[model samples]
Target: MAQLSTEVYWHSTEPTEVGPPLDGDASCDVCIVGAGYTGLWAAHFLKQAEPGMSVRVVEAKFAGEGASGMNAGFVQMTAGKVLRRMLWYYGAEKAGGVYRAVARSILEIGRFCRQNGIDAQYENTGILQVATDTKQLARLELQIKRAQRAGVTSFRLLDREQAQERIGSPTVLGALKVSGALLNPYRLVRGLARVVQEQGVLLHEQTPAQTIEKVDGKWRITTPHGTITANEVIVATEAMQGAFPELYARQMPVWNYLLVTEPLTDEQLGRVPWPGREGVANSLSFSTAARLTADNRVLWAGGLWYMFGNRDTDPRHRRNDDAFDKLGASFREFFPQWRDVRFSHGNGGLISWSHSFIPQFGRTDSGMVYGHGYTGSGIAASHTGGKILRDLVLRRKTEFTELAFVTVNQPKFLPAPFGDKGGEFFIWRQRVGDRLPLLLPYKSALAPNRFFARRTGSPERATAGRSSD
Candidate 1:
């Protein structure tokens, strides 16, 4: 049998030419590490805001080599339990503002693609979060109520009948429909890189930031073959930011897996009446998301989140046979009518998970601004993150800076061996939780406990649903 392709379907479809790495010493007004979504969007906004600002982007690999390209492509608005925690920490007013900003970004991304003529297979197919069991249904209902209380009005609860009308998933008891979008992630990131380069932002691929130091009021970034000195530097490396000592204790890199099935024939597609092509996910801790590709294939991901000790980013971790087997079993369980559907691709990527399960943005004492720790959801949020990074670089006290993610002090994870062990333990517990419902067929109507919400100092137990993209 042929081995499953580890390359992500998105990157395989459209390959981008790698730019030359930095050759020697260079200087710029702003230097950004990691040419992924955060860096690319930051550069686009910074140049648009101040056309003459000399912005330079340095990448460890080609653009979109990380999560930006490998993600499942759900531009969702759900921020797990972070919104409820924000309400308690920053009060309802500011917390609501943060929620609105991320929601707006989902639309803004679509607009950006349209204006720039980026054919990234952008679709405004909203997200459908289904409840596979009675316990999950209770969680779904509670989540809708909490979302409304937090000033999110875009979500609507769907009964089983209504959900079945949309997508015939036998496991779906009910669903929460929300406004979200789906797109070709690789195409989007690569297109953004081209657009920014067109705007005169210098980009160097295959250039890794070996070390960073501040000397004479300038931030110096050292790469293997070259160095970049700039008035300001933004570390947007996301999961890979652990290389910096200051950020090491603030985030953990967790591996997220994905699989894409071979294109379904029209007769096979007729078995499931998914005319809307909505981005769909179930209410599991490590949720499973599925969406139809432009070519009629089904892309499913999540349900198994892995973490290697020392937060390693080995390429070998990209393909997990165990994860693929579980995902295939899940696909069959959800749609028994298409039991023989084969997968064409299987891959995984790293997600920077913060201790608080919220994205972090702030400036270090050394004058370097950073943003990461999106947990598993960053596609839409990263656009907002880009705006926040821009405001931080400009040193202007704008609404973006006042958001909870910026104004609050982000909690740190346990150090070193403890951190790694703790992360592994957490993943193991989640896996056990995922399997419990199967062993015990009894379903509970009571809402499940919200551990992250309580840990974040929130009195209300918000729903536990982590969207992946």
Candidate 2:
């Protein structure tokens, strides 16, 4: 199949446009360059933490127009990280601390919405990570143990039978259920913009940064219509950091796409069961992620994802459509019963990738406090990143420096140009354990992409997807 090519997702149908462009020189204590959750939240919390500080946001397109708006909307609690990685990255205890920071972000989001009077269809129904085979089940077991040690209160292990009953899918051999929330990412972004505006933060949309420089010992971020002179500049544009090359080298881009089925009839809905409205991902991790929306549609995504905003750059958006179709067809083979269901929308967007495939945060040599490279797992991490960046500028301690960035000796990401063949091959090796049952057991270093086999029917449950925050 042609590899998936965009990250714009479920809420792609939601309307959007560049906010009014910058008109002239703007001065602020802190200037955020992207309006996605990270930038907006930075503005909001900064105002909360220090109300007098001037804050401004500038976006190439509208808020949520990037990964934040184009994801499966799964708010990953720290409860979702692989146990071994935590052990390796932070040596168990510290890893748990990182996880705690992520877990707390869920509550932070709710508080942000309620306090701001922005209703983004936030539902605290939790999430499910299912393993479709013995190997995957074993991986789930490690995750369960790790979560327990990390002090996570809401993670539970489900065996094959119990998992099947809980998810209404017999293909699942194991699952990890934990506390999380579902959201209309589009609504969430809109709500954030509204709140940030109310808090007195200026927003500049459709204003791409032509150049960023430091003049007279201050940071100057310039666009076509205006410039932002601030004590500090926050580069929250996770994937599209085209304005800075240092960022591009540290954070790479990959393609992922999502499609939603027409609202499932009460009849079809009955056949598929979930506990309230939980988000879902697969245990194998070939980058598939899915979620239940505020509406009844099931939104799903996978593969080489990219985003060309406004769907204006190219019609057919052929690459993403094929990825969506692959996911749809895979879903059909797993549950032939849903084949006739109509699809109301098909869309794609971008997910940021760090050199280490880990989300990163902190300052740069250019005096630009940077926070990009989510590598598709931004949801809760984004919130934490914002807080960390805020602290960095304010001269406070942050865990950002401690988190391990995806680097050399780690799985060398496939070189560009090989495309799908290389991607699928890499995926297959990492995931073989999941698809092959007990053959290889599990390893934090064990890649899960090799296991992308069999319909398993349920794609999202096997791997958590990316987000804009």
TM-score of each: 0.92, 0.82
Candidate 2 achieves a global lDDT of 0.65
- State the lDDT of candidate 2 residue by residue for 366-430, as single tens digits: 76777776666677778887777777777765464455431112332333344334544545666
Could you give candidate 1's per-residue lDDT for residues 311-413 as a string of tens digits? 8888899888888888888888988888878888898899999887778899887778999988888999899999999999999899899888898778888
Tell me which residue pairs clash in candidate 1: none
lDDT of 1: 0.83
Ten consecutive residues with minimal summed lDDT in candidate 1?
Answer: 460-469
Report residue 39 deviation for candidate 1 (angstroms). Answer: 0.6
